[model samples]
Target chain A: MSVTAAKGFTAAGIAAGIKENGNPDLALVVNNGPRRAAAGVFTSNRVKAAPVLWSEQVLASGQVSAVVLNSGGANACTGPKGFQDTHATAEKAAEVLGRGAIEVAVCSTGLIGVLLPMDKLLPGVETAAAQLSEHGGEKAAIAIKTTDTVHKTAVAEGDGWTVGGMAKGAGMLAPGLATMLVVITTDADVDSAVLDEALRAATRVTFDRVDSDGCMSTNDTVLLLASGASGVTPEYGEFADAVKTVCADLARQLIGDAEGASKDIRIEVVGAATEDDAVEVGRSIARNNLLKCALHGEDPNWGRVLSAIGTTSAAFEPDQLNVAINGVWVCKNGGVGEDRDKVDMRYREVHIVADLAAGEATATIWTNDLTADYVHENSAYSS
Target chain B: MSVTAAKGFTAAGIAAGIKENGNPDLALVVNNGPRRAAAGVFTSNRVKAAPVLWSEQVLASGQVSAVVLNSGGANACTGPKGFQDTHATAEKAAEVLGRGAIEVAVCSTGLIGVLLPMDKLLPGVETAAAQLSEHGGEKAAIAIKTTDTVHKTAVAEGDGWTVGGMAKGAGMLAPGLATMLVVITTDADVDSAVLDEALRAATRVTFDRVDSDGCMSTNDTVLLLASGASGVTPEYGEFADAVKTVCADLARQLIGDAEGASKDIRIEVVGAATEDDAVEVGRSIARNNLLKCALHGEDPNWGRVLSAIGTTSAAFEPDQLNVAINGVWVCKNGGVGEDRDKVDMRYREVHIVADLAAGEATATIWTNDLTADYVHENSAYSS
Candidate 1:
C-alpha cells in the first residue's frame, strides 16, 4: 500500500490539531529515489493559498524530495503567517528527512485564512516520520481530505513497475479540474524530464476532465514522484498509459464521493471533429446541474442530456448526433430513438454516450449526479 | 400591459394543449411597423430546440413582423416533427395576420420532445388573434413559462418612447446565459440594422452574463421589436442603455425566482484588463456552488470567495485581488481584510465584488444562492 509501488516514495500521516475531530491532518511523502525529479500542477484559481505559492516556486527546480500537506486549516489569507507556516512545514520535513527544504512541497486545505499551530504541527510531523511505513498509503490519503467522505486510492501493476496514488476532494470538482489534492508514486525508472512530461499529459485528460460542482480549488496539487526502485525502465509511452489509468480510476472514485452524489456518471463524447471538441462538449454536459439532477432521479431524461450537449461549440449538427444512456439508444440523428425508460439510473454508476457525427475523436469525463443530499450537505457546511 | 404598447402591433394567448397544466399555451405578438426591422438571439446550446431552428433562420433576414410562441411542451428533440410544429405555428400566425410565415417569429417552452397538440392548436391561433389586446403583455409572458414561480416584466420610460419587456425562467441560469425567454418591445423609431447591432451588444453583456445553475437551455430566446409610434428615436447610445436596463432588471427578477432560491446574488468583477476578463472572473465565482451555498446560510464565507476567484485566468496578482461579501471587504489583496461579521447575507439579495487589480474593465453577473428547496425541487422533477 505504499507509494513506492508507483515509483520512489515513503508516506506518513499524523494528527496535527488542524481539525476539531482530531482526525489525522498532517501528511508527508518523500521521493527517496534515483533522482530528485518531480512535476507539480497547482490550482488555476487566481486566489491561491500560501502553500500553493511556496510549492509553485519549489517545483520550479523540478527537484522535489518531499511533500507536506495539512487539512482542516487552509493557511490561506493568513498573510505572512500563512507563508511562514508553509516554509516551516517544508523546513521541518527537510530537517527530518535530511534534504534541502527547496526540494519539499506544501499543500493545505479546509477552512481558509487560518493560522497553523506550529507547536502541534511540528511535533506531529516528527511522529509521522517515526511512524512512516511501507504500508502507510491509506492513512496518508485519509489525512489529506476535507469534506471527502471516503479515501480515494488506486494501484495499477504494470509489466515490471506499478502506479499507485491517492486523492481528496468533493463539491468543488469541475471540468477545468477538480478541487483535488493528488499524489502519485511510481517505482518505474523514469527521468525527471520524462516524469514532468508524462504527468502533465496524463492529467490533461484525466483529472482535468472531471467536473462535479464547477468550482476550482486554490490548493489543488497533483504530484508525480518516481522512485526507480523497480529496476524496470519502461518506455515513456507505457509509463504514461499506466499513469493515465491510475488517475482515471482515482478520479472516478473522487466523483463517487462527491457531495450528496448518488451516481458516479461517465459522459463519453465521441465522433467529434477533434479531441478538443469532444472534450469541450463532454465537459460542458458534465458540469450541467440540470442534467446531473435528471440523472440522480433515475428518470433517464435524455432531453436534458441533449440540451446540455447543445451548450458547447463542437460543430456538430444537433440532428446528426446520437445519444445512448446506460447502453440504451435513446436518441439518433437528434431525435428520440429508444424508450428512455429502458435505461435505469438506479445504480450508483451511470453511463451517457454521445456521438457527435463529426470525425473520429473521443473523451470521457467523470462526474456526479445532483441530489437533494448534495444541496443539504453543501448548504449546511458552515464556514 | 400588451406588447403592442410600442405601437403597430397586436398580441394574443390561447389554449393550445402544449402544457399539461392545461393553461393557455399559445401566444402571438405581431409588429405593425414603420420599419420591418427586428433582431433576435437564441440559445448557444449546440442541440437547439425545434423553434430555435426556425427562429435562427428567420432572424437572418432582420425583418420580422410577428412572433408565435407556445408554452407547456418545448417541441425540443421531437425531431422533424418539432421543426414542423414551429413552422406550422409561424405559418398559421402569418396567414391569419396576412403576411408570409417567414415574417413571423416562433418560440416555445415546457416539456421537451412531446408532440404539440396540433389538433387543437391550428384553430387556437384564430382564437388568440381575436383576443389580441393592448393589455395582453402579462398573458403572453405567462403563456411561455414552464417552471417559473412567477412571471416577470419591466417597463422603462424614455422622454419620447418606452421600453417594456417580460421574461420567464427560474433555474439553469449562468453567465453565458439563462434558460430564459424574453420579449422586449419599444416604440422608438429605430432601423432594423441598428436594432440588430444594439441588441447583440447589449445582450452579450447583460442577459448573457448570468449563471444561475450553470445549465444552458435549449430554448432560450430574446427578441426585440420596435414600432415607430413614438416618432421619437433617441440616440442609439441612449437606446442601448434603456434596453440594457430592462434586461438587467429582468435578469435580476429571474434570479429572484430561481428555483428554491431565497436570495438573489450579484457578482461584480472589476479592474480587469478587459471586459471579457471581468466577465470570465465574475462568472467563475458566481457559478461556484460552495460559495453560493455559504451565502445561502448567511455565513460570509470569504475563504470560498477568494478561492473561487483563484480559479480564473484574468491577469491579477493573487495578493492584489480584493473580494467583498455583501459590500464588506472581506479579503484584501487576496488575503483576509476587515471583519467578515460586518457582511450581512440575511437579506433576499447578496453582492460579491471581486477586484482583479489588472485594468479598468468591469462586469456583473446575477445568480441565486443554493438552497435545500432547490435540491428538493430538482431531484424529483423528472420523476
Candidate 2:
C-alpha cells in the first residue's frame, strides 16, 4: 500500500512563505471521522519546545483530530512567545477545520529561538485546509523537512487495516526519537492504549535504534492517530506488523538522507548472550564517530569496529567476537583475518554483520557516515 | 619542577622527516639510571597498535628505563609485521641506550593502519637519543605531535621531589583516558606498584575527565617512570599532590589544543549526590557537540546545558538544577533566570557550572569547541 492508501486521513502541503527556500514548509493532516483516538511520543530532551509541551498536554486527553506542522522556525527556547505561537497555530488550524484548538496538535522545525510569522502562518493554514486532498500524503511529507533531501513516508495495508507515516530528519540523529519529526495515521479501529503500545514498541526497535551522530534533539516528536475509518478490527499481530513496517521504512529513509552521509550503515549484532547485549553491541558501533568516518572513507577498518564493540558491558569476551563487513569476514576471534580489500564501503548503503559467538540473541542499528558537511552544517548553522 | 627539571631524565625532540611538513616527529626521554621502576596505563580499546601491545607486555614486568616516541605514524592495524616493527624499535633503542630491549618502551602516533617507515624512524631515534639533554623537555613535548597546535607539558615539585610530563592529542578524546599519548617522569622513590597507584589516581581525576569528543582511540598510552635520582622519598601526600597538579595541567593543555577548537569549556557539576553522578552529569555536557558548537558561537544556550544534565542518572529532579555560564547564572531551578547577554563564551576559555542541589559530590570536565576544522581533519584524514 502507498501513503495515500490510508483511510480518513486528508493531507495538504503548501508554501507558507516561512522558509528562505521556496520548499513546501506547511503541512496539515486531519482525521475526517468523529473518532480522534490518538497516542503521541515526544522528544525525551528536557529542554523541550513549546509545541512539544502543548502536544504533550493534548495527548494526555487521548484525543486528536488534526495535526498542523510548519518548517523553518522551531519555536524553541523563545520563552513565553514560543508557547503563544504553538497555541495560535493550533487555534488557527482549529478555526479552519471546524475543530477545537485542544484537539489540534502542532509541530514546528527549523531555526530555533525564532517567533513564528503569524501574518504568513494564519493565511497559510486556511490555504492548507482548502488544498487538502487524499493524494497529499507525499506533499505533507515534503513540507516538514529541514535538512532532509527527500520526503519519507510508508504505508502498509492488510485485513482491511492501514498505517501511513511521514518522517523528517537528516542530522542530530541519535536516541529518544533522534531529532526526527514523524506523523502517522491509521484506521485499524484500535484504542488509544493499543496505539500507544504499538507506537512505543515500533519505535524502540526502529527509530530509537537509528543513531547517526549520537545527537538528540529537543523538538523531536512522533504522533499516531487512529481514525477507525476501516470497519475491520485487526488483531494485535497484524496491527503491530503494520506499524513496524511503516517505522522500518521511514527509518531506512532517514538513514538515506543523513547529512553528508555517503554511507548508510546497518550494524547487525547476533549471537549475543541476551537481547540487551545485542543492542549494546549494535549501539556501540553505531555511535562510533571514528568508525563512521572510516566508513565514509570506504576503508573497511574492521579493527576500529572491534575497538568500539570491546567497550560494551556485554558478557561476550573479546576473543569470541567475529565481525564481517560488506559480507567479508575481516576479523575472527579478535584477530585480523582475510584481505581487507574484499569489503567495499563505497555504496550509499553498507551492511556490517557482527557475530558475538555467544547466545542466539540479535539486534540491528542503522547509522550514517561522518562527513565534512555534517561539521559544516553544525558549526555554521547558528552563525 | 618544570618538564626538563625532572631528575635523571634527558629528553630531545628532532625533525626526523616523518610528517610532510617536516615538523619534529622523533622524541626520546631516558632515565639516567639511579632507578628504573615503571608503570603504564594504556587505552582500554581492544584494537591496540603494535606499540601498545609491546608496551603492555613490557609494563607487565614493571621494569623500564626509557621511552622512545614519534609522531606521524600510529604503527597501528598493520598486522603482524607491525608487531615485529615495534619489537625491533625497542631492541634498537635498547642497543643505543646500553639497556635491555624489555626495559625500553616505545609509542607511535599519527595515521592508523599504515606501516612505519623505518628509514626515517631508525635514524631519527639515533639522533634523538644522542642529542638528549636536560633542557630538551619543550622540544620533546613538540616531537610527539599530530593535529595539536601546540605541545602540552605539566610539572610539579614537592619536598625535593619533582613530577613532570608531556602529552600530544587533538582528537578522539573521551572517557577512560583521553586519546592522547603521554609520558610522565618522576624522581620520587617508589616501586612499580606504588607508581601505578599514583599514576592511576592522578589520571582518574585528570586526563580521564577531559572528554573533548566521545571517541576513544586505539593508541592511547600513559607511561610513568620513577628514577629516584633526586634521592627524595617525600611523604605520600606530597607525591600525590605533585601527580595531581601535573596531570591537571596536562589535562588543561589537551583541551587548549583540541582539534578545531576555538574555546575551551570547563563544565563543573557540583552537589551531584554521588561522584559517578557528578561525572555522568559533567560528561553529558562535555561530549555534546551541539553544546560545544554553541560555545563556539558564544551563545549562552543554558537550555542545552540543562537538557544535557537531565539525560543523566544524577538522581536529581530537573527543577532542582541551576546552571551558570561564564559566571552568570543563566538558568535557575530549571527555568531561565537572567539575560543570557551577560554570559560570554568568546574567550579562549569558557566555564559552565551546574548545581544539582543534591549532595556535595562534584566533577569537572574540560572540552573544546565544535568547529569546521574537526570535521575537515577527520573526513580527509584517511584519504
Candidate 3:
C-alpha cells in the first residue's frame, strides 16, 4: 500500500507509450475526500521542471483534488512550451476527474530538457482515471521510477488514521528535498496548515538529509494530501511523528536503491555547535568523493573524513575531532586510535560517527559510496 | 626546467625508503640567494598536515632558504607527534645547509594520517642536500609524484629574470590551491611583499580555479622564492604576468594528468554580475559529478549544466541562461538550441560556456571528466 493505503484515495498506473521500452509511465492519484487539504515542498534548484512550477501553484491554494504524474520527460528547460505542457496536463486531469484545474498537481520525471509526449500522456491520464483503484499505490510508485530498480512505499498508522507514501529516485540525489517525486496521503482529520508543518518538519530531517550523489536535481517535489476520511483528529505531535516515520522510511529506501550504489553510508555527526553545523559537516563528509571511494574499498580511511570536515566552517578544532567507522574508533583526538584492520566492513551498511566536540547538537546524512558502476550508469544514462 | 630554471636555486630528488617500494620520496630545493624574500599559499582546509603547519610559520618570516618535500606519507592528523616530525625535518634541512631553522620550509604528500619515518627522512634529506644541483629540477619534480603519470614543470622568462615551478598532484585536487605541492622560484630582484602580492594574484586565477576531483587535500602548499640573483627587476605587472603564465601551464598540466580522467573540461562562466558570481558558477559547474560523468561519456547533456548552475546562488535567471558545449549551442535561452548531434566531443579537451546573461564578468574553471578509472584508482589507493 502506498498513497492508496490511506482512506478515500484512488490511484492507477499505466503504460503511456512515453517510455520507449513500453514500461508503466503514467500514474494518477485522486483524493475522493471530504477534506482536500494539501501541502507540497519543491526542489530548491532554481531551474525547476515545468510540473514542479505548476504544482507549486496548485499546492498554494491549500488543496489538491488529484495528482497526475508521468515518467518519460522532465519538462525542464524547454522554455515556454514546457510550462504550457504542464498546464495542459493539469487541465486534462482536472477535466477527467471533474475537479478545478488549479486543484490538480502534475509531476513529471525522466530526462531533463525535454517536453512530455502530450498525446500519449493526456490519453493515458483518461485511462488511468477510469481504472483508478484503492490498491494501486504500488503501481503508482513503479510508474514514477527512472533508474530505480525497485518500488518504494511506506505506511504509518495513528489512533484511527493512517499515512502512506511512495517515492522514486535513483540518482541526482542531494538534498533540496532529495531530488525525487514523493506523494503522501493521510486519512486523518487535519488542516492544511498542520499538513504543511508536518511535511516540512518530516522532510527536513529525512529527505533533506539524504545526499546520495551530491547532485541536486531540477524536479524534486513532495506532496501531502489529507482526506479526513477517518474523522479522528490526532494530536499535532502524533500526526507529525507519523508523517516523519513514513518519510524516514521512504528516505532510507531511497538510499538503499540509489543508482549503482554498493555501500550505504550513514554519517552521524555529533557534538556540533548547532544542528546546522552538524548538517554542514555531515554533507561535506557525504559529498567527499575520495572518502566515498575509500569506504567502497573498505579501507577505513578516517583521514579522509577529517579532511572533509576540515573543509567546512563548522565549529570544531582539528585536533579535537574523533571518528569511528563500523563501531571501531579508527581515529581519536584527530590521530590514529584503534587499528583500522579491526573494523568490519564486510556488511553493505557502513556507519561513521564524527564527533566535533563543540556542542551537543547532532545530525546524520545518508549517502552511497562512489563506485565504478555509478560512473557507468550515469555516464550512459542520458544517451 | 623546473624550480632550478631560475639563477639562484639548486634541487635534488632521492629515494628515501619512506615508500615501501623504494620510489624517490624525497626532494630538496635550496636558494643560494643574495635575497631570500619569499611568499607561500596553503590549503584552506582546517585540518592541515604537520608540514603545512610548520611551513606556514617558516614563510611568516618572509624568507625561505630551503624547502624539503617528501612523498609516501602525508604527515597530517598525526597530532603533536606529526608536528614534531615536520619540525625535525625542517631542522635537519637547516642543519645540513648551515641555515636557520626558521628559514626552512617542509612539504609532504601521499597517504594521509601516517607519520613519516623520521629515521629514513632525515638521512634522505642529507643525501638530497649533498646531491643538490642546478640541473636537478626535473628529478625534484619527479620525486613529488604520487599517482601522477608524469612530472609537471613550467618556466617563463622576463626581460632578464625567469620564473620556474614544479607541481605534483593527481587526485584530491580542488581549490584550496588545487591540492598540490608547488615550488616556484624566481631570480628577479623582488621584495617579500611584492613576491607575496604577485604569487597571490597569479594563484587566484590560475591554481585556484583548477578543481580536478573536488577533494581538497590537507597538505596543499605552494611556495615562491625570489633570490634576486638575476639582478634585473622588471615591473610588477610583467613579473606577475610571467608568474600567472607559469601557474596557468602547471594548472592545465594538473587537469590533464588528473587521475583516470579521459577528458579535460574547461567551464567558462560569462555574463555574471560580479567576478565572484562568475567564479562561483564556474566552480559549481566544474564540481558537478553528473556533468563530469556525462562529459566522460561524450554526451552533450546541457541539462546537467543548467542543473549545476541552478544550484549556485549566482545572479542568473533560469530562463535567460545559455550553454554551449564545444562550439555548438546545445542550450540557448535556457532551452534547446542547436542540434546536440552537431557537437564534436571526441577530443581530450571539452569546452563548456555558460552565459548567465546577467552582467559582463567572466571566469573559467578547469576540471576533468569522471571516469570508471578514477573510481578504481581512488577506491583501492590505500589498500
Q: B-chain TM-score, every candidate? A: 0.95, 0.95, 0.99
- What is candidate 1's CA lDDT for residue B194? 80
In order, the first chain's TM-score in every candidate is 0.95, 0.95, 0.99
Ranked candidates (lDDT, high to low): 3, 2, 1
Question: Whose DockQ is higher: candidate 2's or candidate 3's?
Answer: 3
By DockQ, highest first, what's the ranking?
3, 1, 2
lDDT of 2: 0.83
- Mind giving the per-residue lDDT tens digits that candidate 2 earns over B1-383? 23467888889999999887899998988888588889999988766778999999989988888898989888876677888988998998898999999988999988765678888888888989889899988899988988888888888877787899999988888877788989989988888888898889989999899888787887899998998888988787778788888888888888888877788888999978999999998998887766776677677777667667756767786556788888998777665667677876558889999999999999998888777667566655661
DockQ of each: 0.63, 0.35, 0.81
What's the CA error at residue B305 for candidate 2, in Å? 2.9
Q: Output the TM-score of candidate 2.
A: 0.87
Clashes of 3: 0
> TM-score for every candidate vs. truth?
0.94, 0.87, 0.99
Candidate 3 ranges beyond 4 A from true positions = none
Tens digits of per-residue lDDT for model 2, A25-61: 9999898864678999988877677899999999998
Query: Candidate 2 vs candidate 3: which has greater TM-score?
Result: 3
Q: How big is the positional error of residue A173 in model 3, measured in Å on the Cα after superposition?
A: 0.8
Task: Please give, for residues A337-356, the per-residue lDDT of candidate 1 as tens digits.
Answer: 88877887778889999999
lDDT of 3 at B54: 92
Runs of candidate 1 with Cα error greater than 4 angstroms are A4-10, A31-37, A158-162, A175-177, A230-238, B2-4, B32-37, B60-62, B175-177, B231-240
